[model samples]
Target: MKRVWIAVALLLAVLAGTLSHSFYLNSFTQELTGLLEAAEAKAEQNEWASAEELTQLAHHKWDEKTAYLHILLRHSETDEVYTSFREVAEFIQCQEGGEYSAANARLIAELELLAEAEQLNLKNIL
Candidate 1:
């Protein structure tokens, strides 16, 4: 009975950790996605200054999250996002519509994937 109770406690702790990671990843990505969409929309409307501001705001948020996220998530995934932000900022500076749009699209997709990987699902559990 004591052994069974210990096993349950361990399982619960793992489940809690998985759920926490998933929630954090999903919430951060959604916020970043909003920033990206706003920036992209500004770019589409030819508001370059507004687009740049939004991109910088998004980058600032990413930097803030990185401090804590590095402890919870894979470094590689964080690095991918960090790289994407730089590319987006560069494209915004050059006012390259196609490239900026493409980079944001890929960034959003990758963020979603990162969150999904952390969710407490059967595949992740197995």
Candidate 2:
């Protein structure tokens, strides 16, 4: 029937959109995580300037995606990452290696978890 076809079309559209968004989020998170890891490595080697630059680059990239992220993710989740970025920046400014490492690790973990949460998994569907 016409109604059945319409419903199938709508469902397919939704599925396509979800898959695309998940793919985008996964790639974005991976990119950010790489930047954070590189920054962490630089800091480990006492390359503070390079580390700071990398952190800033990652933060800027995240900021660029803020509006899109906010539309798809909960504000609290997005804000947590924003706050983590600030914490990492502060730790970098103070040259606190231990603190910076911890904060960077946390930020990376958060990004990964955020992407995982958005995947079209059975857990998510339920």
lDDT of each: 0.87, 0.97
Task: State the lDDT at 49 in candidate 2.
Answer: 96
Which pairs of residues have clashing backbones in candidate 2? none
Q: What's the lDDT for residue 112 in model 1?
A: 80
lDDT of 2 by residue, 9-32 (tens): 999999999999999999999999
What is the TM-score of each predicted model, taking all chains together?
A: 0.89, 0.98
Largest lDDT belongs to which candidate?
2
Question: Which residue segments of model 2 deviate by more than 4 Å?
Answer: none
In angstroms, the error of model 2 at 110 is 0.4
Q: What lDDT score goes with residue 41 in model 1? A: 92
Error of 2 at 2 (Å): 0.9
At residue 73, give the lDDT of candidate 1. Answer: 80
What number of clashing residue pairs does each candidate have, in the order they appear? Answer: 0, 0
